[model samples]
Target: MSRTPPGTRADYAAFTPITTRWADNDAYGHINNVQYYSFFDTAVNAWLVRQGLLDITASAEIGLVVETGCRYHRPIAYPDPIEVGMRLASLGNSSIRYELAVFAPGNDTAAAEGHFVHVYVDRATGRPSRLPDALRAAAESLRAPGSGSA
Candidate 1:
């Protein structure tokens, strides 16, 4: 099987810094693989919040994660100051795919790279919903060159 190459910081359009908790480490003395997904989620949602596109308590439209996958280039341990870089890989009527990279402090290349897919849904009905204009614009701001509609 071929491996996907790690992404560089320039490949992303937005960035969010994340602190690794001591508890995030596992018996292997590194951040557990599962924790990378948490980082991805945090980075994306935090960006949404910053853009005023999401209101956890009252937004009528919410995004439900539909898919996620990661590729690890190296293990990162607790206390490592890291940053998650994000960019829109594609956007659809009801879904968006975000490409993310985890970088150690001062690094230009990623230690891990991942993709996360979220399907926008009606908060009350839990059914798929079209992306709101504001949300679409915010998402578009994170699109790297060459990324577009899904």
Candidate 2:
């Protein structure tokens, strides 16, 4: 497979600034590998919440992450402010693929990048559900221009 080059903030549809906590650093002093996934989830969910598309506690439909992966290009440590850039790669009947990148403060290139796929499902029944209209529209708005088949 071809390697994906690190992305810049401009490549994304939206950006969220994240403050790294002291607890995020590992024994080696860099952020733990798993924390990148936390950043991914935070960025996407924050956008969805801001758009009035997600009601974590009461929404009839909720997104359940089905797949996730990340590529690390450099180390990010506590005390370093980070930015998470996010964009939609595609949207399906009940799923959406979100692409994300983590940028060190003031850096143009991503320190890490990744993607996660979430399938919308009934909160109670755990079965696939059609993407809610508002959510779908909001997701569409996050599609990067000329980037993917969203």
Candidate 3:
């Protein structure tokens, strides 16, 4: 999804600190590729929950992941923490695109970078729904002004 290289340390907004477990590593001795997406999911949804936009268990408006992509630059191993940085790339009427970068603790470069698009839908009918006002504003706050020009 990116034309440039892996994200550097400068591009993100809020960071969520995450602990890595021994099981997070694969036989190759690094964090498995699939686990990176889990980090991305946690970082984004945690923000949604904290913003009071998502109930997860009862919210009628649910955001379902429709698309996802990632780019890896380095390997991460257990015994180190992760700083998962996140930002909103776009806030649409019914969806939002979230960009994420996972950096090893105390490191300035990213181990993996990715984006996920979630389309808000009705829990009962599973139909697409417009984003709530509060959620849109929260998403807009994380969007860089000039980042979505294209």
Candidate 4:
């Protein structure tokens, strides 16, 4: 497997604090690999909600995640109060790519980093829809410098 270098807080535009629970640990004593994806989702949605781009119950348009990936640089165990950093890697008419980093308390470098892709769709039809102006603008605000043109 190829190794992925950890990213720093400076690489992201926003952050969400997350606390690891006892259940986050596994038999081996570190966080379960599956939980990392949840952190990514939480961080992304938190930003969207903060920007007023997502209304879970009433929005006609919603983002449906179509792809995701992660690379762990170190183990994160229970009781670690971490922060998940988020930034946009790419934006499109109907899609967006998000880059995320999980940082241990007081650490500048990420313990894990990942990417997630979401395709905007009409909630009723489940068909691809052009991103709303507000959503697009909000995403642009979080675009990483030199990452891509929004």
Q: Which parts of model 2 have CA positions greater than 4 angstroms off?
A: 146-148
Residue pairs with clashing backbones, model 4: none
Would you list the C-alpha lDDT of every candidate in the order shown? 0.92, 0.90, 0.87, 0.90
Q: Which candidate model has the greater lDDT, 2 or 4?
A: 2
lDDT of 2 at 122: 95
Candidate 4 has an lDDT of 0.90
| Model 4 ranges with Cα > 4 A deviation | 1-4, 145-150
lDDT, ranked from best to worst: 1, 2, 4, 3
Worst 10 residues of 2 by lDDT: 141-150
Residues 28-84, candidate 2, lDDT per residue (tens digit)? 999999999999999989988889888889999999999999999999999998989
Poorly placed runs, candidate 1 (over 4 Å): 145-150
2 or 3, greater by TM-score: 2
Weakest ten-residue segment in model 1 by summed lDDT: 141-150
Across 1-150, the per-residue lDDT of candidate 1 in tens digits comes to 987678888888999999999999999999999999999999999999999999999999999999999999999998988999999888889998999999998889899999999999999999999989898888878876565553
When 3 and 4 are scored with TM-score, the better candidate is 4
By lDDT, who's the top model here?
A: 1
Write down the TM-score of every candidate: 0.94, 0.94, 0.91, 0.94
